[model samples]
Target chain A: MAEETSPRGPERRRGDALLRAIHEAALAELAEVGLGQLSMEGIARRAATAKTVLYRRWSTPHELLVDALHQAHPVEVPTPSADDLRTDLVAALKLLTDWMGTPAAGAVLAVMTERHRYPELAEALYSRVFDPRGGTFTSTVLRHYANAGTLDPRRLTPIVTQIGEALVFKLTLDLNRLPTDEELVAIVDEALLPALGFPLG
Target chain B: MAEETSPRGPERRRGDALLRAIHEAALAELAEVGLGQLSMEGIARRAATAKTVLYRRWSTPHELLVDALHQAHPVEVPTPSADDLRTDLVAALKLLTDWMGTPAAGAVLAVMTERHRYPELAEALYSRVFDPRGGTFTSTVLRHYANAGTLDPRRLTPIVTQIGEALVFKLTLDLNRLPTDEELVAIVDEALLPALGFPLG
Candidate 1:
């Protein structure tokens, strides 16, 4: 699989292939043995690569696992052209629910729970994964609503963010179930809309 | 401290003393070292007892820590004789805020998060610590309000429970700040009351 003859040259191709192999191997290991059981030695063995190669790129298992998670759930910036706040929020929430409801994401959360025992790992995960994805989208949608004069501009961010965070918490920690369509609707109608100063009859 | 010392026997006092020592030591260790570092051996050492003594009553660290939590935040059954549902709920929320705001209670929550990794421990915490205590008061307040024609009766429990859970999550996980008195009032008035069909101005 080495692209030695490619126009981009052998070095770039070799690096790309190595990263891909390591990432896939890490994911497969995560699925089979869980995060607590994941190790660089195990991942290198699974990928048919030496442990030195794995350590050269990533210093710790936490860093490697985080990179794998990023690959699995690539960040998508939400454009606020959906006409209304509720529609935009529903779309954003759907995106969040879909990503979090997956088995891989569940494993990620399990790892995160364990990661909390290590504060540095917890901080890394929060900054790299949690905040940028969900937090950004929620804030952007609320800002758009506030700009449009529909929402109370002052409390918009905190309110919408709280609702979104609550939903995520419910899925990950409380109910351990996916958010149903009905729940999505209730959240938007009963919780988010009111907080945004919209009247929902 | 054994309470087994009856008027005719000395056995009762010995049992009571042992239990007291164990309980006090557990609390002290939790406060000083936190949940992550809590261990049965540590508790035994602090209590001036042997590890075998702790193991005789509790099989695992999780069980001992959970029991300690239960003893700390025991279920409080509310007597809702107040005419206004708002007043009763406000009183209950105040109590909840005070309990959750304390450092000791926060330490108990630190242990609860660890319980998430162990499902059985999570279930036990939910049933013993969560549901019986605050859950009962919340349900009673909602039922009383609905019956008195102050709010809608259908699905009141779930709605109120969600709001309460959200508040707790906000304090413990997200914002990491206790809900202010004003914020608590706003939550009850804006979210809980309106969702239960109470008209909010």
Candidate 2:
């Protein structure tokens, strides 16, 4: 009865709100400044919270940033209707492209660089970042076609599925920009579809 | 005769020797401590030279690293005799994989993160790192097969040629290791060959 009636309930709500704010601020900081420049005090400043509040939750900025990436993202790629493999693949990869244009891209890129030094973070990234984020989703889409004999089974491995992501990274690395609509179409029609044994419509 | 006998001859040789030493030391430093942590001062320390010496040559550490990647490397992929596309593609990609397995990979990876910030560097990378190194060779190989009507002309574009590179990065990012020869063979025989039209032997 005391738990239900307690004023502490409001405090709990406030704490949740503060954590949400912190997550947003932390990711924003990571994107703008990168990991080497990230600091707990900076995150706190951005979140409009006290440094003590941050330390109470995370021992270091790295801990906080990693936690933020693990949190559930609002992005939920609409399930492809399995109508056309080309349309389905383009839409799925395009969803991923939008995500890459935001702060999430920079944050993920910074953490990936640290992968060699932190194996634990790498595993966490596999489960929390890559799989849920896009890898598994895209693989399932490609695999569905492979299983149905619409796409060649050999062309449907996880690595093969990332042909779009590779083009995305190539744009990111080569031009330092996300794929243009023209580029996306080219990747889908000119490259990925044909590579997987499906040509243009 | 005066030009050849001038004391400036030894001075020129000495300068060349120091530049070679500096390039080696810079790449080693980049491999050991990535770009985020790299400093011209640290590179000078490792090279056993003055920071002033480095500054005289390069305006910044970024300049030095870029210059190092531009210097000629001993890698020369044997032209695949134009006999078998499979054999040629595998040999060309294999040469690239060998290059990635070296300290050069780390150096290049570090420089790439800076690409988003430096458009000029991006073009330099395209010409010096991507094109002269392997892109042109691989494209020519793929184009040969395409012209023969064996592989689709669509798969012969610069973007399509990156299929092998994408797989390489997938292996590197996901596994933190380069693909084994067997893996490369599978990639060529199982994936690339089929994607481009021709399948297993």
Best by TM-score: 2
lDDT by residue (tens digit), candidate 2, B88-156: 877777777778877766777766775554557556766666675544346667877777887768656
Please list the residue runs of candidate 2 whose C-alpha ends up more than 4 Å from where it truly belongs after superposition. A1-14, A44-52, A72-74, A127-135, A146-155, A194-201, B1-14, B72-78, B118-134, B146-155, B199-201
> In candidate 1, how many Å is residue B100 off?
2.8
DockQ of each: 0.15, 0.28
Runs in model 1 with CA error above 4 Å?
Answer: A1-73, A77-84, A102-117, A126-134, A152-157, A198-200, B1-14, B20-39, B42-48, B77-87, B101-117, B126-137, B155-157, B198-200
What is the model-wide C-alpha lDDT for candidate 2?
A: 0.71
Candidate 1 is scored at a TM of: 0.71
Scored by CA lDDT, what does every candidate get?
0.66, 0.71
Candidate 2 per-residue lDDT over residues A1-201, each given as its tens digit: 354346554433367777878988999987665565689988989987889999999998877877787773556564768568878877777777888776766777767765774557567766766665544446657877777778778666655676777667766666667777777776777667666765444
lDDT of 1 by residue, A1-201 (tens): 684455474343257787887887887776565555678998989987889988898998778977877776665656777787778887777766777656456556545544434567567767777766545556777777778887666665343356665655654455556677667767777766655555456
Indicate the fraction of true inter-chain contacts that candidate 1 also forms.
0.08
What lDDT score goes with residue B118 in model 2? Answer: 52
- Could you tell me the lDDT of residue B125 within candidate 1? 73
lDDT of 2 at A196: 75
